[model samples]
Target: MDERFNVELEQLLQDRGRDFLSLSGVCKVMPSALRARLGLKSNSRVGEVQKALQPHMGRNLEIRKAGRSLCLVRRGEKDEMLLRSVQARPGKSPKTLRNSLPFTAAEFLRLTNSLLKEGRLRVELNARCEPLLFAVSPEGPPTLQPQPLALAPVPDAEAEKAVLRAAFQELEQGRIFVRICDLRRRLGWSREAFDSALARLRRERTVQLHSGDVSAMTQEELQDSFVDENGFRMLSLTWTEAR
Candidate 1:
């Protein structure tokens, strides 16, 4: 039982590529998904198993017991790790590159975008029209570069209103958070437009972006999170009274 649960939890962390998770999140998810039934008798045992597994995780990725949560402790700078990954596996989709390390999706996006901005890396479209990341070195293919984002455009007020209304209804339903990915799918707006609106609302303090428990979300849901300058994916959206 421990083996299966442990592997599942580790994969959840890895698939989401985040550096931190809460024990509350772990306990909530493990039982629900695996139907582990975590009877009151089993909670303490689960904690102990997680603790014993910590040392082993430290080899590739380390986990430390931090109060009521688990946090990944990695050595190198994230940008350095990203460069190495791109060097090893060039021409990979953004999702592939994002999941290549122990950093959070937001962290990956920030550093990757930083590197791209610094000309340390490049992205090219593959045959399937998917963006692929490549190290910008002498050996890298000499391909035309895509246009970079200079600024987050001023958001359309209408689009911002729509996002607010959707979030409000969800909040009124007593849900603590709304998944950005779900909103994206429902809105059917261009990524650029949606991203810009999120940025605007965040800047105006109309909304606050928070990371959901990685354990509660699928890999695609995690990847679909909004990353607007913060170094972690905003998987869940909460609203402010001002909105």
Candidate 2:
């Protein structure tokens, strides 16, 4: 209900490029408890959200809201942390790497792309951050490899479905694992358009891609997965009430 608090917290994360925070973890040390922080019980006034977040705003940190839950993140961490945390095997979810490091969703993608280009790593995602698996290639460092075959363009309906699915995902978690290349082919959008749309979604907290190396996913299966709890940003205690 505190617009200023939400605005400021959003700005702080934007400046630092942080995208998530663990409210449950933060509430333990965040002055008042979670009840007070969320205006649920009144241990802290509505203004407290602002007060608590002000000190930590920017400087590579901020708070974000997904429904009624929150998470924490710091963006000052290095790209090497990403590489170091990943298991030295394939089929590992990049989400594990995200949990081990302080990188944001954007930073995760940028770092992954860079490492992939440099022949240092590869990614295989399951569409969401959680339960993701990642592996470091022992192929003697990362290398840029050309696409073996060009995929024919897909229909706009397919791309629209992808985008719509991504939007719903943002409402829960802040990230989505989408195939940008495939999205482009389906939507008939230029590379720039795809990037721009992604940027807008990120700013609005509508959706995010944690890794560019999204593995191929079947549409029907992904759609089904989105409705399940695991597809959302993270687990929510309150959300269980909806069930």
Query: Candidate 1: which stretches are off by over 4 Å?
Result: 1-155, 167-172
Worst 10 residues of 2 by lDDT: 234-243
User: Looking at candidate 1, what is the lDDT of residue 203?
Assistant: 88
Task: Compose the digit string of candidate 2's lDDT tens values, residues 1-243.
Answer: 456545544554355333444444333333244335455332333245445654545555555433233445444445664665453223334543444344557877798878778766654332232233344457565332322111222246446435544333434453333433333333323333444544444455544444321122322112212112234421111111111
lDDT values for all models: 0.58, 0.41
Candidate 1 lDDT, 71-119, residue by residue in tens? 4434446688678766654555677555535566677779989999989
* TM-scores for all predictions: 0.37, 0.31
Error at 225, model 1, angstroms: 1.2
